[model samples]
Target chain A: MDNKRRKFLKMAGATVLAGIGAPAVVKLTSVPALASGSEQAAAGHGSGHGEEQRTGIRLGMVIDMRKFYGNEELLNQAIAACHAVHNVPEIPGRKSEIKWIWKTGFANAFVAQSQNLRSETVKNSQFPVLCNHCDNPSCVKVCPTKATFVNEKNGIVAMDYHRCIGCRFCMAACPFGARSFNWQDPRPFIKTYNPDFPSRMRGVVEKCNFCAERLALGLEPACVEACQGTGAMVFGDLNDPQSEVRKVLSEEFTIQRNAAAGTRPSVFYIV
Target chain B: MIEKTLKGKPAYWIWLAILGTFIAIGWACYFRQYVFGLGLTGMSRDVSWGLYISQFTFLVGVAAGGLMLVLPYYIHNYKAFGRITILGEFLAISALVMCLMFIMADLGQPLRGLNVIFHPTPQSMLFWDMCVLWGYLLLNVLCGWVILTAERKQVPPPKWIYFFVAISIPFAVSIHTVTAMLYCGLPGRHFWLSAIIAPRFLASAFAAGPSLILLACLVMRKYAHFDAGKEAIQKMTTIIMYAVIINTFFFLLEFFVGYYSEVPGHIHSLEYLFFGLEHDGHVYNNLVPFMWTAALFNFTGLGILAYMKIAKVFDYRLVGTAATLIFLALWADKGLGFVFAGFVPNPLEEVTEYIPTLNELGITLGIWATGFFLLTLLYKIAVGIEHEVEA
Candidate 1:
């Protein structure tokens, strides 16, 4: 009986070791290959041409609230342009709303920056808030699948809707409340279908993708285009000192939504 | 051994039938949720996780609580716990099944549940949670079945079983710790951001888990004609006493840090839960009564337990009452209070109150029923085998 127990222990030990070690070995060997494959896929999908792919560029936005202050129409136009292009639903209730770009009061927009003694105009103003596309995005960090990931080449936080398990950990992790889940089939709510962009299904999380498709086609984001000439919204590489976004940042005193969150938001607001 | 579950008294079958009906109703509600999307639940964009996740969190503790028995019995060779160690393992098994079921029910795309495993991202705490939960489940199932089978054959479980037993000790701890990490690691959620969340989880888990085991033992004694032994019950009761005390202390620590520090982020959720937050003149205090009730039950249960321990009284009825109270207190504290409060005064600092829909409650009840159904079968088998061995 003792000998039999010893043999059984040996077999069990071997099986246990094999079970754990096998996965580790497979993960280690396959990781590099998978990483490269995903990068290539991202590059291919992000920009049709390799030359157009903005490498080493931290894509960011400068929402010059100075230009947008008291002009709710421009804010509405920007929201409409982005939502129309992205096929975001017009779900009425706040419970099942899907928004890529939206407007909120200054206090709601910048909880950390809002002061009790702020000027009436500043206090009353509404700000456009979207995904910050943070350099240290909490959403990406908590995503179980690499469904939502930072575009390493350009620093634009991106999403792969198909891969998303819709666990909403990202939604919880995101300090900005930028991400939205499709609580219902969003297709029925889309008033005018935009065939250019595919509508998300009921069980995926989506947010501002920084208009990766338009960027692929060598065009500015729809929101930026809609706000063109008004110069309310500037979309450019934050890495390039000469870029309009950087120029705006240099000239204006700007702040990020919840900078205290330590997400290092790419989107800045000039209050 | 498997056949033991097939033989049961009429009451046993009736109990199972009732559980089956709840399970059926829950399945029907879940089908509605799956068809219409998660819109059926009270969760909004702000409050993304709701009752399902809350139950998942609490059940993880209940599952981990099983370790209280396993560690003392196998590692320390506490012979009093010998007869009831399998009970702990079996309880853990059923609790984990409920945990997994809750997760599945909560998922937006249930079909894509395997995506976490298929593309494992180590950075995601959820991936680690999934890993640990599944690992713990497998370990318990293996250990419980092997040990129970050996006991049935009137032979010692092979020495090799000790290896799995040893692993499951930490595996049990890891399951709850990892589950805590899921909430605590998030950046902006102030309620879950505290360092003590993991320790508090273990404390409550230890309390809740053993309280449940004691209750089960009581039931088994009366109905199933199985006694877990007086010494074993006494030891377990003592463990619960300390555990409940520690759990309450940990919560007080959180309350002190939140209130004394005067951080709005920290205090808002707690205030919302207990006293109700005054937002724009209207007090959003839906959870206030529930929170106070939990507190009352917790303190009252602690009082009873302390009295019993100090007075050296092992009155079964009093012990049973204390156990039930402690279990319910911990359930409300960890389940409803913890998860819901975290989402309140959301990251945007907006109050979007979430009240689970009737369908949602139906689904929640169903999952719990499914868990009890599993527990009944597993315990029936274990007790039946023990009875046969004695006969």
Candidate 2:
């Protein structure tokens, strides 16, 4: 009986370890560009710790609000693309609607920065705001169930809808108001169902997952891909200094939403 | 003694029936809400938390308020409070029930609430709140029941029960402190993210909790021929007066810091509550009247309290009126107003108005009915025992 009990415990430990370890191994082995000199050079921090370092990719976005100034249609298209791919519901009315990405005025977007003497174009610019996916995410920290967590592999904040208790503590904790709770069943409101992405139930909180799903598919986020020709939005590894997002940040005077809140938002706006 | 409540007068049955009708209506509304999801409520992405959360916050203080009476009787050995400690404990039990119910009603997925327990994250204050509230409830139930049992048998409560009393005092403070932490730790919510929140919650709880108990005692006296002593009521009034003063002071400190520093984020919610604010060419004046009414009642109640304190005369009518007003003042301040203030100029910096829908009100009313129902029944048992002992 003792031997059987020990054997059962050993199997359980192995299963749990395998559940966690298998993903790490798969992620490390799958990234073919791990040893590339350019990738290493771009990853300037170079806190290289062998196998684990391969998945130390910090994903971020650079949104150029200037390009979206008068083109409401362009902004809509990009938002729609993301919503469709992510299976975000369109709950008709504004109140209970689910939004992954949406437009906001420049003043509201860069809340901490001075908007007193901005040019008319800058002031009126409609910036697409979404989850900042903060390096030190407050939502991730406050989530009672660990339903929302920062992916240690890629630094992308991800949500497990099934696990969310719908407490909205994460919603309150989020300084940027990036998170939204599914106030009702989201499935019916979805215009065109995307089987690739799962629809969340009424009680879970969800936000811009930084397109972790598409990233796994080795494709750009729907928003980034839709804004391909326009170059209004760019998504790349922030860890990679040579990446497009990093380059944009380096060249442009970019400002993050609620920077003073010290959340260290990953999403930067080139106003 | 326990069976005595079952043999109440016709008036008792009528009271129960009224509460039951409200509960039935509430449950029916809740069923519809359960089917349709939280969409039935006026809560949105902007005003994510509304009436339910606000009530939960207020009621946590109410539950903690039991400690004010409990500590004096048990810890301080203030024998004057001996008669009413059972009432306070029962009140705590009922208030905790309402607090838990409000939280359950507010959830987007009520069934998944166990997720907090299954995946316990101590870093989250909500988890801590759940632990302390449940523990506090259990403590009150055990201690109150044991003491009552001993009273019936004409014996002092067992020595082991004293240990629970010692634990209950600190545990009571923790419940409200953890509730305050739920709001205080949030960095973005300038209205709630303050050091004053915990102390203010305590003060408000001390004032509102005992004010409510004092009123309940008066009602019990009128209905059940139970007098909790004039001296006892006066002692409670003193507690309420000092606590309300401190509560008012703490509240003013927030206004002072917000205005004096000239920080837009800090002052914006206060401005929205008091004078109203405009967003995108539309003005939100909905909460302005409510805030002013609350302030009026608070000061008027304070005035009455001061008069009574100075005159050295205890007038139940004036004290009762003041208590009722103070209760309403705290209710309005802590309930939807405080909750709504945090979301004003929401995360997106938009002042989208949130008015509770009828469906939401139904659920809230139902929860209140449930609390009152519990209170009435528990008091019936407690009062029956008291009557039996007196005879």
Candidate 3:
């Protein structure tokens, strides 16, 4: 731990002089913002393990809210594609606690972002929220039983429903409320069951899969297919430098949900 | 002699009739539950768990409280309870079976109960709770069966039986404490988020379970001519008195923190429970009545049990009546109204609360009937062995 910190400080000091410090070498840095490079470089002091993944394979999305057109169909298609294939149950009267995909209205969607904003008139912000599939999902950490686990292979949070005790502690820990419980037997609502996905039984929790099955088949998520070519939604490998997702992230500034949490969500919003 | 042994008593006929009737009702409800799904119940997205979950919670408490009997008999070696420790073990087995039945009825898929074990999520308290309960139930059932088999032959078996009973003491408490953790661990949800949740659960279980045992002893005297002796009942009642004191204290703690500091999430659930949340159902009406009843039950029940002057003259019939009423009152307080009140107006603050529909209530009732019917049969078989041992 001590060696890790020293390596970060040394690299951060050099970066301040390398590119960011050149223009500021003559200017007296009155404000930290003016010497942004120093701050950014200073942050590098405590981190280098991230350098390889940051440049090589740190996959992510860059969402741009300014260009959003309040396209309801586009949002629904994305959710449907994932839900349909996952065999997400739709019970009649009792809502069986399984949600592979879902949606929220625009006002509630942007309420957190623009509720306190004074100047910006944030309109047409029909944002879509999913599991966010955080790099450090708290749900996985608090599970005493480890029923919900993060798959290192695909960065997907997976559930072995058989292992879940239906105690719903993960549901309580999750700030997103993304998880749902099976309140009763789920079979009646299964109008169509997909054999591709291993189905969950009642009395356990279920949530978004992020299309791990589709990824294994070399196809994008079902939601991606529904939004394809519309330009409303973009799907690409964040790990690949040539991928469209990475290109968008560079061209436009985007925001992630609950940055304060430091979960490092893969999803992004462009506003 | 074989014909006489096979011949049933009048009480046996009555027990069989009652058990058969409930079993039939349970079967009908289960069929509909499978056909219509959870939609038949009063529960909605906001309130995913309702009456059945509450009953499960209550039964877990009842099951765990069996330790009071164990503590006296095994821990203290009280001879007054010597003839009836097996009865406590059997009661625990029945109560746990009820707990499992309630959980099954509440599940979206009754068959997928094994999923908790097959695809275990270590993160869920629900999973831990399941493990503890399964372990406790298996322990009790094994103990009861072993004792019944050995006692039927009119002799004590190997010494390992005592060791098994001793091990189950803490194991039973673990089941209920884990159940309490299921709620207390939530980040918010004011009504249940308390550090004292597990303690309160144990206290209530101790109060309610031992009270039921007192009633059980009374019934045994009346039906089977077995006297648990007044001294045993009196001693058990003292333990119940202390447990009630602790339970009421923790309950007060929950209310004080909720209303005094006045956090919104904390305050909302109380108001939702007592005064009713603006958009939610009439749980306030149903729950407030029972909350007061529970208060009355706990206070007066403890009052009667604690005071030596009043308790000396206490008839077993009156004790049985009061204890059963108190047991059911607390059951309603924590089990029924509490559950509906917890989730009504939900996290999103959508969806109003309502009593379980006829369908939902019927299904829940069906599950109870199923549990009780099974309990009756198990008791009948055990009691028969006890009778044989007495002879």
Candidate 4:
């Protein structure tokens, strides 16, 4: 080959290599850098301006079900608080019901790992499960429109109800069974309408936003606030090492709903 | 050309009236569903997809099945399929219409479904399925119309029509393969996760698609006095024989993989399908009987088709009977059994059974009637031209 051709080939090869390598290098380095920034945000949470201004903050919850083991009223209060705040409908039938957060047995919650030989207390426990708001959410991936998306700044899987075509691919794709479709008009079944949060229309999928609206208002999730008396649920930014969720993870061993699914669920349970 | 459909006998008019009544009833049911939402269907949070999706999956195969005829006739220059090529193409068009309607019926927000296009996401398989389906539909309409129009004028088809015919061969394969990908690409759904799904989809499509066309040909020969010829029927039978064998082989391969590997994820869906799963004294066996019926029909039809091929027998009655059995078998396999099988023992490891309500059935029947109505009219026009040319 001529010199000019060789130079062109080398340049072309270098361009392709740069194209592939740039993203990998950026991804590998960006996480740790973001971690430090979120730590600062955690320390500065008491400072009102810093908490609201920080980006790339992943808000998660760790629920200690044992705290409320005998107290069904507390559990109900937490669930009711979240639902009312978000305007989640209580549709009459199972076929068409919409739920953001609900309870399921330990066995049902963790299908991948074996729990057959566990104690009665552990086996019979009603664990409050919601959208894992995973680090890698399948629902966000399968949505045909950008109706469901992961916010890069905060890593919360968010939904745009207006843009959703209601194809329900996300419902099928979600392994956690976290998403729910609005089967009929939700207005009739909602006992007390929360005028603050807009009620969703029929046909769109809705799930626990981890109380994104509350987070924006510099308040903890409604469920977390409701559980404050019992101290069952702890909410904080997972990226921040100084955050309460990180301290809880450091101090105690906790398990996610389905670890093998590889969704990296934000919701952890300390049994 | 439209006048030809209008001139059919009293029997045709009666058929039209029957189809029209069902269409009307189906629309009335759909209107209720539209007002109330998909709550009217048997689908639940656990089983979000139901009858409409299953029918869509089955009809996509029927739509892609057109390639079996189009390939042999156009690409290979096989003269035997000359008469019925239009029939296959028109059959695809009708099936596609039903497929689109089924999708619309299944959507929670049919009105906002265009949001998929308004804000397209390449990451989602549904977007790709839509692209391929629409392209395939347009390709068939253009090719079928141009060729049929040329035939009526007593001239060779326009050169541009061949470009569409060539593109359609691959486009047809993509449509069903893309449809399979819609299910197969899902991460945790074990039943649809197999790599063999796309190939099996094509194989089943070939078996089901040609069988339906063959039966339609037999009906046309008897009723409309239009013969698709002995050579054509025998050739199509050979296609069905190989397709049925391959389809069965792929299905058995899945069973072997699931059973031998002994993986719980893979085995759970099949176990629930072939045998009922019991949880907390509640038994779910809705699909057990249906799955067994599908196996019986598939194997019996496979045996009959294989014997015909080996014996070199070409009895129209026997072939038509076998085709009917295979068609129904795949209808059960792809339609009733496969779609909801993935959702059994749903993600939460809880069983939620699905049984379509009467309203759902009415809508399904309406879609079928609408398909047949389109088929009747299109075939009537084609047969009229054939009669005119022969005379």
Candidate 5:
């Protein structure tokens, strides 16, 4: 090849190499900064409440079905408390509804455990279901953008509304049907907007965060606090054996929703 | 040269105008969808994916189907296909363009689409799908354009072009396979959780893709006076025939597994799709007619193609009809039947049937028109060049 041609080839090759390498280097350097930025955002949201940020905590919830079994009013109150605090919209239809926590028949809740000749109590009772914050959360596994993620600092399955692309891949992956998408603008539907929590925009997925913000503020989840005196809903650190959740889990004959799914849900029901 | 597309006949201009009108309407509908949100569509919380995603899945098959032509001609040294390999590559380019548009339309935060690139989670199947699809599109455009340019100049393509062509062969397979893995790897969606999904996707794509190419070739032969050789068309028909049989067989395997296992999780979605699941004394059977129609068309098309192969008499009219039937059948099967069926009983065992609204349909039609518009332009250029070479 002529010298001019060879020189042109070398320049083109270098240009191609630089084109491929430049973005990669930038992405690698930015990843840690982005991660820390998200961590700081998580911390900053819960920081001003004067509670020390806790780490090495696997937050868990236990619902004693015995207390909640026949109490429809109490269950509704618990659901209301969570929704009211979190600014979850009260959309009218099943299609566009944003539900953080909701009640369903026991058979529907625990499909595997339901027997053909089950007692009327088990069949008639309503179970309040929420995000299990599974140790192996399938939602987190499928999130292409890591918008919905398991908080490493505390095992709360959380949503970064700003980051969510609304692909709903997480919704398909979540065995529990815990995630809800903002199919439309959610603000108009919120009758009473809680200033403390941010309402999501249209085209993003939102779900129960196990009240990660509340937990950071040294407070129990809204649902757990709603049923505080009744001992129906218990929220605490599962990593701490002395914590109420672990104590209750150890003592009670508890079952998880779709245990066979192998997601290892942190939420359990005392049957 | 692309300039060839600019000076087409009145029919071509009229066709372009028609496509432009549909594209305009689709864009307007998409604007409404953007403003109103995905709630404007039939998709609910239960059926999170509907027409947009279904079309994306189907078109991915169409895009990958280009491999049927590329593989045989390049790997097997089939000289007959030499006349029309560019057509296959260009077809792939158009289909992939539609595939990407459908994905963009399906997203909730379409603007945040860059987040997929920004985050780059290797664990997510969607990430790999994005990678493979973009790579395949690039490879096809490069291979098709470079080769066609070389052919136009009456010279052999550069040695480097063959390297890219080889990469594109496997790259085509990966696009559809990765798309399948998007559904199959998910936990608890039993309808999509099978090992056969990738194979099934490939089988249907092979049938659908070449069926489209066959139809296009017949059209060009009649109108543009461009012939892709009789032997090449016959061989393609045989390939489509076997592909249709294999596609049907793979689907049946899914049925056998679902029915024989007696696993409610496995059977429920299939039942909901085909026979309508009864819930609260109301049967959800919206997709039943469509699925059955797909079955009918698929079998009928298969029979016709089989007859054509056996008789050794290729009638252009009959071939065109069979190709259309098979194309529509695969579209209904992969596009309509496959996607929402996975979401039918949902993860919670609740049945919520999806029926796309007018806005959704309009947008879908628009994307398809856009693809065809691109296809027409590309074919015009290719056929124009071929005519020049003949002259």
Candidate 6:
């Protein structure tokens, strides 16, 4: 119906409002004026500039080894919190993977340490693993759809499982091996549906969304809260100097996992 | 038996009953998989691809393998293959059908299988494999259809169909080459990431495919009885022998590179398969033994078939056995080992061995059964009407 009216107006030359006698009335009656009088008119012009401006809120994290003492409970708490909030699987099986967060050693544990020595065996160490939310994440580049994307809002690299086709290319491209494909539907165990995190079906790939929901709610991530006594993970806005992560990163030396890969990971760990 | 008249057979009913029963069982499992997700399959994070994919890969080699026979007869103008030429084309079509359907059943999201179609990524080898396999299938189908239609009408086909056949000749070679490229392109996989992988795949396809076709022709002659002409198979055996020799040579090349380079990633899978992983879940069952058997059969078959020209009393059986051995040997080396050797010593260089569960084996059997049924049905239509054996 709208298309027909637009065609009729186009045919009558009324589509081009500049030629109309009442320019003021045309401006007032325009879609912009109808959208939100003065504020929108000003904001719309500002939005053009807004898109050009780099977002100042560059979210990041810094891990301080001064705090960690090999506490599995604290580590488990942090991992479970992130998983719970993000609807990561409570089940621990092969075929049904629902891991938004997991664990491994410094050597085998990818992300911050792809080439760390100890390929042969372990050496009294463990680490919580999550999406580094890399500046140039390999997972994002290889995605067939723009399902995996880095948002400018807070520089969080997020995954939309609904848009995922589960080709497993993202899994292959991820230098951190952060991505996992949904080999099975993830809906059986939930007594009630959680609106915060969307459930993924079989045949789509998924990864950590970096607690975008908690960020929207103006709350710290579940991992951050659980890391309370653990002292290892220090998640905060790296853009703000006053932020704990920023302060920690500035005062202490830190390195990224597979720094040579050139992904420029956001997660910082002192290993 | 098929030539006397259109008559009834007990084997047909038994085949139907067996196929129907298995399809029903497979459908039940497929439904359970749909409801629960890939949870029904034995695959996990570590073992991402399981038996379904392996079977599909093996079947594709078997299908595209038909090109080995098709090329010598049509392209080289081997007059010896006269009556048997149609039989090769017929077997190729059935094998291709089985290969494609097996792939369809392997998907976790079988319904969204169209995503690969609707949104194809050219960079992904999966897309290219789909293209090559489909191209080979269509090319063979059109060539066979045109030729058979012309034979039925007792007239020569339009000149272009033969040109299409000419194009399909090299294209048949490309199908399995592209299939190997699917694995060869993956960088991290030490076993699959070889340069000779694609050429080696073609070599095996030629050796195994024509040998299988020759054996199938013999079976056709023996049962539901059609004289697919022995002379054509004699020429086909020649092609098979050459292919087996090339394949064996390329196989040796891979071994030389792997051993000389001493790269752990390259050597690990080979070590695990032959020498056995000194740790968990390591079974040396049939790895070295089967490999040597395949080599022995190929060597002996090549000597007999290429020398006696497949006409010697013993040559026929040796060629058939060699082809069968090559097919099964490549199947194990490529399929099961392809999956197992890939993730071993783990990508992270950790040690997590794989043991396929019973559920996984059941699904694999179900898919294989489906492929066989499809082959059976297609060959019935194809072999029944094959009067293209012009003297």
- Fnat per model, in the order given? 0.77, 0.81, 0.28, 0.86, 0.81, 0.29
Instruction: Give the winner by lDDT.
Output: 1
Can you give the DockQ of every candidate in the order shown? 0.55, 0.60, 0.19, 0.59, 0.57, 0.21
**Recovered native contacts, candidate 3:** 0.28
Compute each candidate's TM-score over C-alphas: 0.92, 0.92, 0.74, 0.91, 0.91, 0.77
Please tell me the interface RMSD, in Å, for model 6. Answer: 3.4
**Residue B19 of model 4, lDDT score:** 100
lDDT of 3 by residue, A196-236 (tens): 88766655778876665565554556776666555555544
Write the residue-wise lDDT of candidate 1 on A13-74 in tens digits.
44334643211111111122123222322233224233233234567888888888778889
Off by over 4 Å in 1: A1-55
Worst 10 residues of 6 chain A by lDDT: A39-48
Q: Model 1 lDDT vs. the true structure?
A: 0.86
Tens-digit lDDT track of model 3 for B260-313:
987555666667656656542334444566567777776776666655536467
* Residue-wise C-alpha lDDT for candidate 4, range B1-391, written one tens digit per residue: 8889889788899999999999999999999999989889999999999999999999999999988999999989999999999998999999999999999998888889899899899999899999999999898889888898889889999898898899999999999999999999887688998999999999999989999999999998989999999999988988998898899899889999999999877887788788887778987888999889888988888888788878877788888888999999899889987899899878888889899999999999999999999999999988998888888
Query: Against the true structure, whose DockQ is highest?
Result: 2
lDDT of 4: 0.84
Cα error of candidate 6 at position A9, Å? 50
Query: DockQ rank, highest first?
Result: 2, 4, 5, 1, 6, 3
Across B1-391, the per-residue lDDT of candidate 1 in tens digits comes to 7798898899999999999999999999999999999999999998899999999999999999989999999889899999999999999999999999999998898899898988899999999999899999999999999999999999999999899999999999999999999999888899999999999999999999999999999999999999999999989988998998898899999999998999888999999999999876778999998899999999998898788878887799998999999999999999899999998887667788889999999999999999999999999999998998999
Looking at model 5 chain B, report the run of 10 residues with the lowest lDDT sum. B344-353
The true-versus-predicted C-alpha distance at residue B85 of model 1, in Å, is 0.6
Per-residue C-alpha lDDT of model 2 across residues B1-391, encoded as one tens digit per residue: 5587688889999999999999998999999999998889989888889999999999999888888899898878899999999999999999999999999998888899999999999888888999999999999999989999999887999999999989999999999999999999988888988999999999999999999999999998898998999889999999999999999999999999999999888998999999988877888878999999999999999999999989877888998999999999999899868889898988668778899999999999999999999999999999999888889
User: Which candidate model has the greater DockQ, 2 or 5?
Assistant: 2
**Who is ahead in TM-score, 1 or 3?**
1
Misplaced by over 4 Å in model 5 are A1-56
Instruction: State the fraction of real interface contacts model 6 keeps.
Output: 0.29
Q: Please, what is the whole-model Cα lDDT of each candidate in the order they appear? A: 0.86, 0.84, 0.65, 0.84, 0.85, 0.62
How well is each residue in A1-271 modelled by candidate 2, as lDDT tens digits? 3443234234324433464422222221113222221222222233434312223466788888778888878998999999999999887876887788998887787777787999988777678889988877888878888998877656678998889888899988999888888888888888899998888888789999978777665456788777766778877656644455666888999888997676778888777
